[model samples]
Target chain A: MEESKQEIRLPRLGEPAPDFEAPTTHGTIRLDDYKGSWLVLFSHPADFTPVCTTEFMAFAEIYEELQKRGVELLGISVDSITSHIAWVRNVEEKAGVKIPFPIIADLNKEVAGRFGMVHPGQSKTETVRCVFVIDPNQIVRAMIYYPLTTGRNMAEVLRLIDALQTIDQHGVATPANWKPGDMVIVPPPNTQEMAKERLKQRYECVDWYFCKKKL
Target chain B: MGCISPDGTPTESGKKMLLALQKGLRSPQDIAKETGLPLFRVRSGLRDIAVAGLAEQKDDSYELSPKGTELVASLL
Candidate 1:
Protein backbone atom coordinates (compact mmCIF):
# COMPACT_ATOMS: atom_id res chain seq x y z
CA MET A 1 0.00 0.00 0.00
CA GLU A 2 2.79 2.39 0.86
CA GLU A 3 4.41 1.62 -2.46
CA SER A 4 1.35 2.88 -4.27
CA LYS A 5 2.05 6.36 -2.99
CA GLN A 6 4.88 8.49 -4.28
CA GLU A 7 8.05 8.39 -2.25
CA ILE A 8 8.99 11.44 -0.19
CA ARG A 9 12.55 12.70 0.12
CA LEU A 10 13.73 15.31 2.59
CA PRO A 11 15.62 18.25 1.10
CA ARG A 12 19.20 18.65 2.27
CA LEU A 13 21.11 21.79 3.14
CA GLY A 14 22.18 23.88 0.09
CA GLU A 15 19.53 22.06 -1.98
CA PRO A 16 16.37 23.61 -3.34
CA ALA A 17 13.30 23.10 -1.16
CA PRO A 18 10.70 20.88 -2.76
CA ASP A 19 7.88 22.80 -4.39
CA PHE A 20 4.24 21.84 -4.02
CA GLU A 21 0.73 23.26 -4.18
CA ALA A 22 -1.59 22.43 -1.28
CA PRO A 23 -4.76 23.71 0.27
CA THR A 24 -4.09 25.89 3.28
CA THR A 25 -6.34 27.65 5.78
CA HIS A 26 -5.69 31.03 4.12
CA GLY A 27 -6.25 29.49 0.64
CA THR A 28 -4.40 27.47 -1.92
CA ILE A 29 -0.72 28.33 -1.99
CA ARG A 30 2.42 27.06 -3.64
CA LEU A 31 6.10 27.02 -2.80
CA ASP A 32 6.73 29.33 -5.77
CA ASP A 33 4.47 31.94 -4.14
CA TYR A 34 7.10 32.32 -1.45
CA LYS A 35 9.82 33.05 -3.97
CA GLY A 36 11.99 36.14 -3.40
CA SER A 37 11.37 35.71 0.35
CA TRP A 38 12.85 33.52 3.01
CA LEU A 39 10.53 30.83 4.39
CA VAL A 40 10.15 28.75 7.50
CA LEU A 41 8.36 25.51 6.70
CA PHE A 42 7.45 23.67 9.84
CA SER A 43 5.34 20.62 10.77
CA HIS A 44 3.82 19.45 13.98
CA PRO A 45 2.44 16.09 15.05
CA ALA A 46 -1.15 17.28 14.96
CA ASP A 47 -3.28 20.32 15.53
CA PHE A 48 -4.85 21.16 18.91
CA THR A 49 -2.29 19.16 20.82
CA PRO A 50 -0.75 20.99 23.78
CA VAL A 51 2.76 21.14 22.41
CA CYS A 52 1.54 22.17 18.97
CA THR A 53 -0.69 24.84 20.46
CA THR A 54 2.19 26.38 22.36
CA GLU A 55 4.36 26.31 19.25
CA PHE A 56 1.67 27.96 17.15
CA MET A 57 1.27 30.69 19.72
CA ALA A 58 5.02 31.23 19.76
CA PHE A 59 5.21 31.26 16.00
CA ALA A 60 2.37 33.76 15.87
CA GLU A 61 4.19 36.05 18.27
CA ILE A 62 7.23 36.05 15.99
CA TYR A 63 5.25 36.32 12.76
CA GLU A 64 5.59 40.08 12.51
CA GLU A 65 9.22 39.99 13.48
CA LEU A 66 9.89 37.44 10.77
CA GLN A 67 8.01 39.50 8.21
CA LYS A 68 10.15 42.49 9.02
CA ARG A 69 13.12 40.50 7.79
CA GLY A 70 11.37 39.40 4.58
CA VAL A 71 10.67 35.93 5.90
CA GLU A 72 7.38 34.03 5.73
CA LEU A 73 6.05 31.15 7.79
CA LEU A 74 4.14 28.11 6.56
CA GLY A 75 2.93 25.39 8.90
CA ILE A 76 1.66 21.95 7.95
CA SER A 77 0.09 18.86 9.44
CA VAL A 78 -1.95 15.83 8.32
CA ASP A 79 -5.15 17.39 9.62
CA SER A 80 -7.97 18.63 7.40
CA ILE A 81 -8.47 22.26 6.42
CA THR A 82 -11.52 22.55 8.59
CA SER A 83 -9.56 21.36 11.57
CA HIS A 84 -6.87 23.91 10.88
CA ILE A 85 -9.39 26.72 10.62
CA ALA A 86 -11.10 25.68 13.81
CA TRP A 87 -7.80 25.37 15.63
CA VAL A 88 -6.68 28.81 14.48
CA ARG A 89 -9.96 30.34 15.55
CA ASN A 90 -9.84 28.59 18.88
CA VAL A 91 -6.28 29.64 19.44
CA GLU A 92 -7.02 33.25 18.57
CA GLU A 93 -10.02 33.35 20.84
CA LYS A 94 -8.18 31.77 23.74
CA ALA A 95 -4.68 33.20 23.33
CA GLY A 96 -5.65 36.41 21.50
CA VAL A 97 -2.71 36.11 19.12
CA LYS A 98 -3.55 36.02 15.45
CA ILE A 99 -1.82 33.43 13.26
CA PRO A 100 -0.76 35.54 10.34
CA PHE A 101 0.55 32.68 8.24
CA PRO A 102 -1.27 29.96 6.39
CA ILE A 103 -1.52 26.49 7.81
CA ILE A 104 -1.35 23.87 5.05
CA ALA A 105 -3.92 21.10 5.30
CA ASP A 106 -1.84 18.17 4.26
CA LEU A 107 -4.66 15.64 4.54
CA ASN A 108 -3.26 13.37 1.90
CA LYS A 109 0.11 13.24 3.64
CA GLU A 110 1.73 14.07 0.31
CA VAL A 111 3.55 17.08 1.74
CA ALA A 112 4.20 15.46 5.10
CA GLY A 113 5.66 12.31 3.61
CA ARG A 114 7.66 14.31 1.12
CA PHE A 115 9.15 16.27 3.96
CA GLY A 116 9.65 13.06 5.99
CA MET A 117 7.40 14.57 8.62
CA VAL A 118 5.53 11.34 9.23
CA HIS A 119 7.50 8.90 11.29
CA PRO A 120 5.83 5.51 11.34
CA GLY A 121 7.39 4.54 14.60
CA GLN A 122 6.19 7.69 16.29
CA SER A 123 2.53 7.49 15.32
CA LYS A 124 2.27 6.31 11.72
CA THR A 125 -0.37 9.00 11.17
CA GLU A 126 1.15 12.15 12.60
CA THR A 127 4.22 14.21 11.73
CA VAL A 128 7.02 14.77 14.19
CA ARG A 129 8.06 18.30 15.01
CA CYS A 130 10.18 19.45 12.07
CA VAL A 131 11.43 22.81 10.88
CA PHE A 132 13.08 23.74 7.61
CA VAL A 133 14.63 27.13 7.09
CA ILE A 134 14.73 28.05 3.42
CA ASP A 135 16.48 31.11 2.09
CA PRO A 136 15.09 33.59 -0.41
CA ASN A 137 16.76 31.60 -3.18
CA GLN A 138 14.66 28.58 -2.12
CA ILE A 139 17.72 26.72 -0.89
CA VAL A 140 17.21 24.93 2.40
CA ARG A 141 19.59 26.45 4.95
CA ALA A 142 18.92 24.42 8.06
CA MET A 143 16.73 21.67 9.48
CA ILE A 144 15.74 20.98 13.08
CA TYR A 145 13.61 18.30 14.68
CA TYR A 146 12.29 17.86 18.16
CA PRO A 147 10.59 15.12 20.07
CA LEU A 148 6.87 15.43 20.68
CA THR A 149 7.34 16.24 24.33
CA THR A 150 9.60 19.22 23.71
CA GLY A 151 8.20 22.47 22.36
CA ARG A 152 10.50 24.28 19.97
CA ASN A 153 12.43 27.36 21.00
CA MET A 154 11.08 30.32 19.05
CA ALA A 155 14.04 32.56 19.89
CA GLU A 156 16.47 30.02 18.48
CA VAL A 157 14.45 29.82 15.28
CA LEU A 158 14.51 33.57 14.83
CA ARG A 159 18.18 33.70 15.68
CA LEU A 160 18.89 31.03 13.08
CA ILE A 161 17.00 32.97 10.42
CA ASP A 162 18.97 36.07 11.32
CA ALA A 163 22.21 34.10 11.27
CA LEU A 164 21.43 32.65 7.87
CA GLN A 165 20.54 36.03 6.43
CA THR A 166 23.69 37.53 7.89
CA ILE A 167 25.81 34.78 6.39
CA ASP A 168 24.08 35.19 3.06
CA GLN A 169 24.68 38.91 2.93
CA HIS A 170 28.25 38.78 4.27
CA GLY A 171 29.51 35.33 3.14
CA VAL A 172 30.71 34.51 6.64
CA ALA A 173 29.63 31.84 9.11
CA THR A 174 28.50 32.51 12.66
CA PRO A 175 30.35 31.07 15.62
CA ALA A 176 28.83 28.64 18.08
CA ASN A 177 25.91 30.06 20.08
CA TRP A 178 26.03 33.10 17.83
CA LYS A 179 23.62 35.97 18.23
CA PRO A 180 23.18 39.28 16.48
CA GLY A 181 26.16 41.65 16.94
CA ASP A 182 28.38 38.71 17.81
CA MET A 183 31.69 38.30 15.98
CA VAL A 184 31.26 35.90 13.06
CA ILE A 185 33.71 33.26 11.98
CA VAL A 186 35.83 33.91 8.92
CA PRO A 187 35.91 31.24 6.27
CA PRO A 188 38.88 28.96 6.77
CA PRO A 189 41.88 29.44 4.54
CA ASN A 190 42.13 26.88 1.74
CA THR A 191 45.90 26.77 1.33
CA GLN A 192 48.79 26.49 3.83
CA GLU A 193 50.17 29.84 2.67
CA MET A 194 46.79 31.44 3.21
CA ALA A 195 46.49 29.78 6.63
CA LYS A 196 49.90 31.15 7.59
CA GLU A 197 48.89 34.58 6.38
CA ARG A 198 45.58 34.34 8.25
CA LEU A 199 47.40 34.02 11.58
CA LYS A 200 49.17 37.33 11.00
CA GLN A 201 45.89 39.06 10.09
CA ARG A 202 43.94 41.15 12.63
CA TYR A 203 41.18 38.58 13.23
CA GLU A 204 41.19 36.74 16.59
CA CYS A 205 42.51 33.28 15.94
CA VAL A 206 42.19 30.42 18.41
CA ASP A 207 44.14 28.53 15.79
CA TRP A 208 44.56 28.56 12.00
CA TYR A 209 41.51 26.29 11.78
CA PHE A 210 39.41 28.69 13.84
CA CYS A 211 39.16 32.46 13.56
CA LYS A 212 36.53 35.08 14.28
CA LYS A 213 36.23 38.58 12.84
CA LYS A 214 33.77 41.36 13.42
CA LEU A 215 31.17 41.71 10.73
CA MET B 1 30.10 12.15 19.16
CA GLY B 2 31.56 8.84 18.16
CA CYS B 3 28.12 7.39 17.53
CA ILE B 4 26.88 10.25 15.42
CA SER B 5 28.52 11.71 12.35
CA PRO B 6 29.13 15.45 11.98
CA ASP B 7 26.18 15.53 9.58
CA GLY B 8 23.88 14.15 12.36
CA THR B 9 23.60 10.66 10.97
CA PRO B 10 23.81 7.74 13.41
CA THR B 11 26.90 5.57 13.05
CA GLU B 12 26.49 1.80 12.61
CA SER B 13 26.34 1.10 16.34
CA GLY B 14 24.07 4.06 16.83
CA LYS B 15 21.73 2.70 14.23
CA LYS B 16 21.80 -0.64 15.95
CA MET B 17 20.89 0.86 19.28
CA LEU B 18 18.06 2.84 17.69
CA LEU B 19 16.79 -0.34 16.09
CA ALA B 20 16.95 -2.08 19.40
CA LEU B 21 14.98 0.75 20.99
CA GLN B 22 12.36 0.45 18.27
CA LYS B 23 12.03 -3.25 19.19
CA GLY B 24 11.11 -2.10 22.73
CA LEU B 25 14.45 -2.65 24.38
CA ARG B 26 15.22 0.11 26.84
CA SER B 27 18.02 -1.00 29.14
CA PRO B 28 21.56 -0.49 27.91
CA GLN B 29 22.33 -4.13 28.64
CA ASP B 30 19.22 -5.25 26.80
CA ILE B 31 20.06 -3.11 23.79
CA ALA B 32 23.57 -4.47 23.70
CA LYS B 33 22.31 -8.01 23.96
CA GLU B 34 19.66 -7.47 21.30
CA THR B 35 22.03 -5.81 18.82
CA GLY B 36 25.05 -7.99 19.73
CA LEU B 37 27.05 -4.78 20.24
CA PRO B 38 29.39 -4.29 23.17
CA LEU B 39 27.97 -2.67 26.32
CA PHE B 40 30.21 0.38 25.93
CA ARG B 41 29.18 0.84 22.32
CA VAL B 42 25.52 0.55 23.25
CA ARG B 43 25.99 3.14 26.00
CA SER B 44 27.77 5.45 23.57
CA GLY B 45 24.96 5.08 21.05
CA LEU B 46 22.39 5.79 23.77
CA ARG B 47 24.27 8.96 24.64
CA ASP B 48 24.11 10.03 21.01
CA ILE B 49 20.38 9.35 21.02
CA ALA B 50 19.95 11.50 24.12
CA VAL B 51 22.02 14.28 22.60
CA ALA B 52 19.86 14.21 19.47
CA GLY B 53 16.74 14.37 21.65
CA LEU B 54 15.61 11.09 20.23
CA ALA B 55 15.66 9.24 23.51
CA GLU B 56 15.27 9.97 27.19
CA GLN B 57 16.99 8.51 30.18
CA LYS B 58 14.58 7.26 32.80
CA ASP B 59 15.99 5.89 36.03
CA ASP B 60 18.47 3.24 34.87
CA SER B 61 16.98 2.61 31.41
CA TYR B 62 16.67 4.51 28.15
CA GLU B 63 13.49 4.86 26.14
CA LEU B 64 12.82 6.16 22.69
CA SER B 65 11.51 9.67 22.77
CA PRO B 66 9.07 10.69 20.06
CA LYS B 67 11.93 12.08 17.98
CA GLY B 68 13.96 8.91 18.35
CA THR B 69 11.01 6.76 17.39
CA GLU B 70 10.45 8.94 14.35
CA LEU B 71 14.06 8.60 13.36
CA VAL B 72 13.93 4.83 13.65
CA ALA B 73 10.78 4.70 11.56
CA SER B 74 12.31 6.88 8.91
CA LEU B 75 15.32 4.58 8.86
CA LEU B 76 13.08 1.61 8.21
Candidate 2:
Protein backbone atom coordinates (compact mmCIF):
# COMPACT_ATOMS: atom_id res chain seq x y z
CA MET A 1 0.00 0.00 0.00
CA GLU A 2 2.78 2.38 0.96
CA GLU A 3 4.67 1.47 -2.20
CA SER A 4 1.81 2.73 -4.40
CA LYS A 5 2.17 6.15 -2.82
CA GLN A 6 5.68 6.63 -4.20
CA GLU A 7 4.23 7.87 -7.50
CA ILE A 8 4.70 11.43 -8.65
CA ARG A 9 2.13 13.69 -7.06
CA LEU A 10 0.75 16.96 -8.28
CA PRO A 11 2.57 20.08 -7.30
CA ARG A 12 1.37 21.21 -3.89
CA LEU A 13 -1.18 23.94 -4.72
CA GLY A 14 -2.22 26.85 -2.46
CA GLU A 15 0.99 26.09 -0.60
CA PRO A 16 4.62 26.91 -1.03
CA ALA A 17 5.84 26.27 -4.56
CA PRO A 18 8.82 24.02 -5.03
CA ASP A 19 12.18 25.77 -5.24
CA PHE A 20 14.78 25.21 -7.92
CA GLU A 21 18.04 26.63 -9.22
CA ALA A 22 18.41 27.11 -12.95
CA PRO A 23 20.70 29.11 -15.24
CA THR A 24 19.30 32.02 -17.21
CA THR A 25 20.86 34.38 -19.67
CA HIS A 26 21.66 36.86 -16.93
CA GLY A 27 22.45 34.34 -14.21
CA THR A 28 20.99 31.54 -12.16
CA ILE A 29 17.84 32.03 -10.12
CA ARG A 30 16.58 30.01 -7.15
CA LEU A 31 12.79 30.01 -6.99
CA ASP A 32 12.83 30.66 -3.23
CA ASP A 33 14.59 33.99 -3.75
CA TYR A 34 11.24 35.63 -4.34
CA LYS A 35 9.69 35.23 -0.93
CA GLY A 36 7.01 37.63 0.33
CA SER A 37 5.73 38.16 -3.17
CA TRP A 38 3.56 36.53 -5.80
CA LEU A 39 5.09 34.61 -8.67
CA VAL A 40 3.48 34.12 -12.07
CA LEU A 41 5.23 31.02 -13.27
CA PHE A 42 4.22 30.69 -16.91
CA SER A 43 5.41 28.59 -19.81
CA HIS A 44 5.40 28.83 -23.59
CA PRO A 45 5.71 26.15 -26.25
CA ALA A 46 9.11 27.13 -27.56
CA ASP A 47 11.34 29.92 -28.79
CA PHE A 48 10.50 31.76 -32.05
CA THR A 49 6.83 30.91 -32.02
CA PRO A 50 4.27 33.50 -33.21
CA VAL A 51 1.53 33.05 -30.63
CA CYS A 52 4.01 32.89 -27.78
CA THR A 53 5.56 36.14 -29.07
CA THR A 54 2.27 37.97 -28.68
CA GLU A 55 1.72 36.54 -25.20
CA PHE A 56 5.16 37.55 -24.00
CA MET A 57 4.67 41.02 -25.39
CA ALA A 58 1.36 41.32 -23.61
CA PHE A 59 2.98 40.29 -20.32
CA ALA A 60 5.74 42.82 -20.91
CA GLU A 61 3.21 45.54 -21.58
CA ILE A 62 1.62 44.89 -18.21
CA TYR A 63 4.82 44.23 -16.32
CA GLU A 64 4.57 47.39 -14.25
CA GLU A 65 0.99 46.66 -13.23
CA LEU A 66 1.87 43.18 -12.04
CA GLN A 67 4.89 44.54 -10.19
CA LYS A 68 2.72 47.14 -8.49
CA ARG A 69 0.62 44.29 -7.12
CA GLY A 70 3.78 42.89 -5.49
CA VAL A 71 4.03 40.04 -7.97
CA GLU A 72 7.01 38.83 -9.94
CA LEU A 73 6.86 37.06 -13.30
CA LEU A 74 9.02 34.06 -14.09
CA GLY A 75 8.86 32.78 -17.65
CA ILE A 76 10.34 29.41 -18.47
CA SER A 77 11.05 27.20 -21.47
CA VAL A 78 13.20 24.26 -22.51
CA ASP A 79 15.18 26.58 -24.76
CA SER A 80 18.81 27.35 -23.94
CA ILE A 81 19.98 30.72 -22.56
CA THR A 82 21.33 31.74 -25.93
CA SER A 83 18.03 30.78 -27.55
CA HIS A 84 16.06 32.59 -24.87
CA ILE A 85 18.26 35.65 -25.26
CA ALA A 86 17.87 35.59 -28.98
CA TRP A 87 14.13 35.06 -28.78
CA VAL A 88 13.55 37.82 -26.25
CA ARG A 89 15.72 40.15 -28.26
CA ASN A 90 13.97 39.14 -31.43
CA VAL A 91 10.62 39.81 -29.87
CA GLU A 92 11.82 43.14 -28.52
CA GLU A 93 13.18 44.15 -31.86
CA LYS A 94 10.20 42.97 -33.87
CA ALA A 95 7.39 43.70 -31.41
CA GLY A 96 8.97 46.75 -29.71
CA VAL A 97 8.29 45.56 -26.17
CA LYS A 98 11.07 45.06 -23.69
CA ILE A 99 10.72 41.79 -21.80
CA PRO A 100 11.67 43.00 -18.32
CA PHE A 101 11.79 39.78 -16.29
CA PRO A 102 14.05 36.75 -16.22
CA ILE A 103 13.19 33.60 -18.20
CA ILE A 104 14.47 30.29 -16.87
CA ALA A 105 16.46 28.16 -19.30
CA ASP A 106 14.91 24.81 -18.44
CA LEU A 107 16.95 22.96 -21.03
CA ASN A 108 16.99 19.91 -18.82
CA LYS A 109 13.23 20.40 -18.34
CA GLU A 110 13.58 19.77 -14.59
CA VAL A 111 11.20 22.59 -13.83
CA ALA A 112 8.82 21.75 -16.68
CA GLY A 113 8.64 18.08 -15.70
CA ARG A 114 8.01 19.07 -12.09
CA PHE A 115 5.15 21.34 -13.15
CA GLY A 116 3.63 19.00 -15.79
CA MET A 117 4.33 21.51 -18.53
CA VAL A 118 5.60 18.96 -21.02
CA HIS A 119 2.69 17.12 -22.60
CA PRO A 120 4.48 14.54 -24.73
CA GLY A 121 1.76 13.54 -27.20
CA GLN A 122 0.93 17.19 -27.64
CA SER A 123 4.53 18.13 -28.27
CA LYS A 124 7.16 16.06 -26.54
CA THR A 125 9.96 18.57 -26.07
CA GLU A 126 7.78 21.65 -26.00
CA THR A 127 5.80 22.98 -23.08
CA VAL A 128 2.11 23.57 -23.48
CA ARG A 129 0.60 26.80 -22.17
CA CYS A 130 0.46 26.72 -18.37
CA VAL A 131 0.32 29.48 -15.82
CA PHE A 132 0.80 28.94 -12.12
CA VAL A 133 0.20 31.68 -9.57
CA ILE A 134 2.13 31.11 -6.37
CA ASP A 135 1.83 33.22 -3.27
CA PRO A 136 4.73 34.32 -1.06
CA ASN A 137 4.68 31.06 0.84
CA GLN A 138 5.24 29.21 -2.45
CA ILE A 139 1.89 27.42 -2.43
CA VAL A 140 0.31 27.61 -5.84
CA ARG A 141 -2.80 29.73 -5.68
CA ALA A 142 -4.07 28.98 -9.20
CA MET A 143 -3.14 26.87 -12.17
CA ILE A 144 -4.38 27.16 -15.77
CA TYR A 145 -3.32 24.71 -18.40
CA TYR A 146 -4.05 25.33 -22.08
CA PRO A 147 -3.61 22.99 -24.99
CA LEU A 148 -0.69 23.44 -27.39
CA THR A 149 -3.13 24.82 -29.92
CA THR A 150 -4.29 27.74 -27.75
CA GLY A 151 -2.91 30.89 -26.20
CA ARG A 152 -3.77 31.88 -22.62
CA ASN A 153 -5.92 34.74 -21.41
CA MET A 154 -3.67 37.41 -19.92
CA ALA A 155 -6.49 39.66 -18.68
CA GLU A 156 -7.98 36.76 -16.72
CA VAL A 157 -4.66 36.06 -15.05
CA LEU A 158 -4.37 39.58 -13.68
CA ARG A 159 -8.02 39.61 -12.73
CA LEU A 160 -7.54 36.37 -10.78
CA ILE A 161 -4.73 37.89 -8.77
CA ASP A 162 -7.02 40.76 -7.95
CA ALA A 163 -9.86 38.39 -7.06
CA LEU A 164 -7.61 36.26 -4.87
CA GLN A 165 -6.36 39.32 -3.05
CA THR A 166 -9.87 40.64 -2.61
CA ILE A 167 -11.05 37.32 -1.18
CA ASP A 168 -8.14 37.16 1.23
CA GLN A 169 -8.87 40.68 2.44
CA HIS A 170 -12.66 40.38 2.72
CA GLY A 171 -13.21 36.64 3.34
CA VAL A 172 -15.66 36.46 0.48
CA ALA A 173 -15.64 34.51 -2.74
CA THR A 174 -16.19 36.12 -6.09
CA PRO A 175 -19.28 35.27 -8.09
CA ALA A 176 -19.37 33.67 -11.50
CA ASN A 177 -17.60 35.68 -14.22
CA TRP A 178 -16.68 38.13 -11.48
CA LYS A 179 -14.64 41.20 -12.22
CA PRO A 180 -13.22 43.89 -9.99
CA GLY A 181 -15.94 45.95 -8.24
CA ASP A 182 -18.46 43.13 -8.65
CA MET A 183 -20.48 41.91 -5.64
CA VAL A 184 -18.82 39.12 -3.63
CA ILE A 185 -20.39 35.92 -2.41
CA VAL A 186 -21.07 35.70 1.31
CA PRO A 187 -20.75 32.47 3.22
CA PRO A 188 -23.94 30.72 4.26
CA PRO A 189 -25.17 30.61 7.84
CA ASN A 190 -23.87 27.93 10.23
CA THR A 191 -27.26 26.73 11.44
CA GLN A 192 -30.47 25.46 9.84
CA GLU A 193 -32.36 28.34 11.44
CA MET A 194 -29.73 30.68 10.13
CA ALA A 195 -30.04 29.05 6.72
CA LYS A 196 -33.81 29.60 6.78
CA GLU A 197 -33.20 33.19 7.83
CA ARG A 198 -30.61 33.55 5.04
CA LEU A 199 -33.21 32.61 2.45
CA LYS A 200 -35.38 35.38 3.86
CA GLN A 201 -32.48 37.85 3.95
CA ARG A 202 -32.50 40.26 1.02
CA TYR A 203 -29.71 39.32 -1.41
CA GLU A 204 -29.45 38.84 -5.15
CA CYS A 205 -30.75 35.45 -6.16
CA VAL A 206 -32.11 33.91 -9.31
CA ASP A 207 -33.66 31.95 -6.49
CA TRP A 208 -32.23 30.75 -3.10
CA TYR A 209 -30.53 27.98 -5.03
CA PHE A 210 -28.20 30.46 -6.73
CA CYS A 211 -28.06 33.34 -4.32
CA LYS A 212 -25.15 35.72 -3.77
CA LYS A 213 -24.57 38.09 -0.87
CA LYS A 214 -22.57 41.22 -1.31
CA LEU A 215 -19.93 42.03 1.26
CA MET B 1 11.66 0.97 -22.07
CA GLY B 2 8.22 2.59 -22.13
CA CYS B 3 7.21 0.62 -19.02
CA ILE B 4 7.70 2.77 -15.97
CA SER B 5 7.72 1.74 -12.34
CA PRO B 6 5.11 3.04 -9.91
CA ASP B 7 7.74 5.45 -8.68
CA GLY B 8 7.07 8.13 -11.35
CA THR B 9 10.31 7.28 -13.04
CA PRO B 10 11.36 9.88 -15.60
CA THR B 11 11.36 8.45 -19.09
CA GLU B 12 14.98 7.75 -19.98
CA SER B 13 15.16 10.48 -22.64
CA GLY B 14 14.82 8.16 -25.62
CA LYS B 15 12.59 5.50 -24.13
CA LYS B 16 9.83 4.24 -26.41
CA MET B 17 6.79 6.48 -26.07
CA LEU B 18 4.00 3.95 -25.79
CA LEU B 19 1.58 6.57 -24.58
CA ALA B 20 2.24 9.07 -27.36
CA LEU B 21 0.89 6.49 -29.76
CA GLN B 22 -2.42 5.79 -27.99
CA LYS B 23 -5.61 7.07 -29.56
CA GLY B 24 -8.85 7.63 -27.64
CA LEU B 25 -9.73 4.58 -25.54
CA ARG B 26 -13.41 5.73 -25.65
CA SER B 27 -14.64 3.78 -22.61
CA PRO B 28 -13.64 2.06 -19.38
CA GLN B 29 -13.47 -1.19 -21.30
CA ASP B 30 -10.73 0.13 -23.57
CA ILE B 31 -8.93 1.93 -20.74
CA ALA B 32 -9.15 -1.18 -18.59
CA LYS B 33 -7.96 -3.44 -21.35
CA GLU B 34 -5.22 -1.13 -22.54
CA THR B 35 -4.07 0.47 -19.29
CA GLY B 36 -5.09 -2.19 -16.79
CA LEU B 37 -7.03 0.45 -14.82
CA PRO B 38 -10.31 -0.46 -13.18
CA LEU B 39 -13.21 0.30 -15.50
CA PHE B 40 -15.22 2.33 -12.99
CA ARG B 41 -12.37 4.45 -11.65
CA VAL B 42 -10.81 5.05 -15.06
CA ARG B 43 -14.03 6.55 -16.42
CA SER B 44 -14.58 8.85 -13.45
CA GLY B 45 -10.94 9.75 -12.87
CA LEU B 46 -10.81 10.52 -16.58
CA ARG B 47 -13.73 12.94 -16.24
CA ASP B 48 -12.39 14.46 -13.01
CA ILE B 49 -8.72 14.77 -13.98
CA ALA B 50 -9.50 15.74 -17.56
CA VAL B 51 -10.28 19.17 -16.14
CA ALA B 52 -6.73 19.17 -14.82
CA GLY B 53 -5.27 18.04 -18.20
CA LEU B 54 -4.61 14.40 -17.27
CA ALA B 55 -6.03 12.22 -20.07
CA GLU B 56 -5.96 13.72 -23.54
CA GLN B 57 -7.08 12.60 -26.99
CA LYS B 58 -4.63 11.84 -29.75
CA ASP B 59 -6.28 11.49 -33.17
CA ASP B 60 -8.95 9.12 -31.78
CA SER B 61 -7.34 7.26 -28.88
CA TYR B 62 -6.40 8.23 -25.30
CA GLU B 63 -2.80 8.58 -24.20
CA LEU B 64 -0.84 9.99 -21.26
CA SER B 65 1.73 12.70 -21.34
CA PRO B 66 5.08 12.12 -19.70
CA LYS B 67 3.99 14.26 -16.79
CA GLY B 68 0.50 12.80 -16.61
CA THR B 69 1.90 9.28 -16.97
CA GLU B 70 4.30 10.10 -14.18
CA LEU B 71 1.34 11.28 -12.16
CA VAL B 72 -0.79 8.15 -12.68
CA ALA B 73 2.16 5.82 -12.48
CA SER B 74 2.95 7.30 -9.09
CA LEU B 75 -0.64 6.83 -8.00
CA LEU B 76 -0.28 3.11 -8.71
- The CA lDDT at A44 in model 2 is 92
Question: A1-215 in candidate 1: lDDT tens per residue?
Answer: 56554344677899888878787765456776666678899999898899999999999999989978878899999999889989999999998978877888998898887777876657778888999998877888999988777899999999999999899889999988999999999999999999999999999999997999997
All candidates' TM-scores?
A: 0.71, 0.67
Instruction: Please give, for residues B1-76, the per-residue lDDT of candidate 2 as tens digits.
Output: 1123335342321122233223424543465456553232243334333434455655534566565666655544
Tell me the tens digit of each residue's lDDT in model 2 across A17-114.
76687765434556765565788999999889888888889888878888778788889999998899999999878878899877889998898888
> Model 2 scores what on Cα lDDT?
0.70
| The best candidate in terms of TM-score | 1
Tens-digit lDDT track for model 1 on B1-75?
547666988877788888888866488778967987545346656766788897899875898899888889989
